[model samples]
Target: MSIIIITGGSRGIGASAAKQCAAKGMGIILTYNSHPAGAESVVRQINAVGGKAVALALDVTKVRSFAAFRDDVAKALKSTWGKDHIDGLVNNAGYGNFNAIEAVSEAEFDGLLNVHLKGPFFLTQALLPLMAAGGHIINMTSATTRVATPGAAPYAAFKGGLEVLTRYMAKEFGPRKIRANAISPGAIRTDMTSKAFDQSPEFVTLLAGQTALGKIGEADDVGRVIASLLSEDNGWVNAQTIEVGGGYNI
Candidate 1:
């Protein structure tokens, strides 16, 4: 069976992607940092549907842990799916910290940098050996990178770097038949952003007004896209940033 790893697969886009990919017959090895319950719930949902899935702990901010995490992934692949390599990886683990640039501290800046850009780079490097031929790598970026939203300067800048790094991953890993792409999601309703939407109905309405679709996206909106990109049907799609934001700020 084809196997894939999704970081931050406990909730939101990653969790939805794990379920969708499993439904398509891909074995899943999903990672979570603190939300073990959410991760296990996702695994159970996949297994309930007769799909194979497993969850592991991963803190994306710690680059030092990737090697060990890779080891854990290898064990999961062998034990769960009897596979030695993974066909895909979705670097979907991240958090949101909205702070103006002038008020953003160095610690906050470094934290965002570590998770959004630096961690994906190193984690992919650590896991590259176990990636099979024709494997795909996905980097979850943001529409904030393009829209210049005020309190998200550091986050947007880091996601922008990740988008660029996606292109380079495609360029460098192309010879190995591994494709790379970025999914820039606009205002999406996930646990991460749900509180904001709940806090301000006006904020949600304003964002919806700016979007061409007249609505913010759900986790499924982006999840299905991630699964589709992992499929053989979209092998020709590479090194491209496909925004799934309902055409926000257009």
Candidate 2:
């Protein structure tokens, strides 16, 4: 069976992606930062359905720890799937921050940069050795990169950088027959945005109005796409940034 590692799989889109990928008969090694319970819950759910999954702790922002994290992944592969290499990776761990550029603090900007850009770069580099030939890498980005959302300047900037990095990864890893692509989601209702949706109904309505489909997305909307891309169904798709928004800002 194909084995895949998804970071930030404890909750939100990452959690959904883990379940979806498992449903497709892939062995999952999902990582969580601060939420081991959430990750374990996902693993249990997958196991309950006769799918195999394992949860490990990972803090993506800590580039220094990626080597150790890679070791843990190697161990997981061996113990859980009896495999030495992973078929795919999903760089999906991140947090949301909303602040105007003029008011954004240096710490805030650096935090976003570390998690969204630096983390993916080094983590991918660290895990490259364990990636099997013909493997795929999926970077989870955001539609804010395309739409220029006002309060998401730093976040969008880093995600845009990740999109560019995706192309570069495809170019560099082509010799290994590895594919790289990005999923750009728009206004997905996850734990990350639940507070905004609850506290400000107008915010939700405004986003819905901006979308051609007249509604924001659910986690499954993007999760299923990620699973399909990881599968052989999208073997020819590479170096692309697929916007999973329902035609927002078009």
Candidate 3:
């Protein structure tokens, strides 16, 4: 079975992707930092349906912890699937921040930078040794990179960086046959974005109005795309940024 590691797999797009990947017969090692309960719940959901999944704790911002996290991943692979290698890594762990460029503070910028770009860079570096030849790497980015969302400057900037990094990863790892790609979703109803909706109720309707599909995206909408990207069927599709939005801002 293909063994995959999905970061931030406790909820939102991460959790949805974990379950979807499991549904397709992949062994999942999902990571959660603050939401153990949510992670366990997802494991149970997968197990109840006869799918195999395991949850581990990971704080993506702490580059120091990545070496240890890779070790834990090694242990999980050995123990759970009796495998010594990972087939794929989904760098999906992230949060949302909303502030215009002029008003954005340094802490906010650094926080977004740490989690969205720096964390994924070092984490991928740390895990590359354990990743098998032909392994896939999927970086979760944001469509805000293209849409120029007013309050998402820092977050969008880092996601844009990650998209660029994905291409580089594909170029560099091509010799190893490890493919890398970015999935850029627009206006998904995730925990990170919902927090903003709590403060501004019209945020949802406004986004929906802007979308060609006439609705905000659900977690599973993007999840299915992510799971499909990790599958062997997409092996030839590399160094691409697939926008999974329902035609948002277009």
Model-by-model lDDT, in order? 0.95, 0.95, 0.94
Residue-level error in angstroms, candidate 2, position 15: 0.3
**Candidate 2 residue-wise lDDT at 206:** 94
Model 3 RMSD, rounded to 1 decimal: 1.0
Please identify which of the two predictions, 2 or 3, would achieve the higher lDDT against the true structure: 2
What value does the lDDT take at residue 16 in candidate 1?
Answer: 94
User: In candidate 1, which residue ranges exceed 4 Å CA deviation?
Assistant: none
31-137 in candidate 1: lDDT tens per residue?
99999999999999999989999999999889899899999999988888777899999999999999988999999999999999999999999999999989999
lDDT of 3 at 215: 90
Model 2: runs farther than 4 Å from truth? none
The candidate 3 region of ten consecutive residues with least summed lDDT is 192-201
What is the C-alpha lDDT profile of model 3 across 38-97, one tens digit per residue?
Answer: 999999999999999999999999999899998999998889889999999999999887
Q: For each candidate, give its TM-score against the true structure.
A: 0.99, 0.99, 0.97
State in Å the error of residue 92, model 2: 0.3
Candidate 2: give the clashing pairs.
none
Q: Please give the TM-score that candidate 3 achieves against the real structure.
A: 0.97
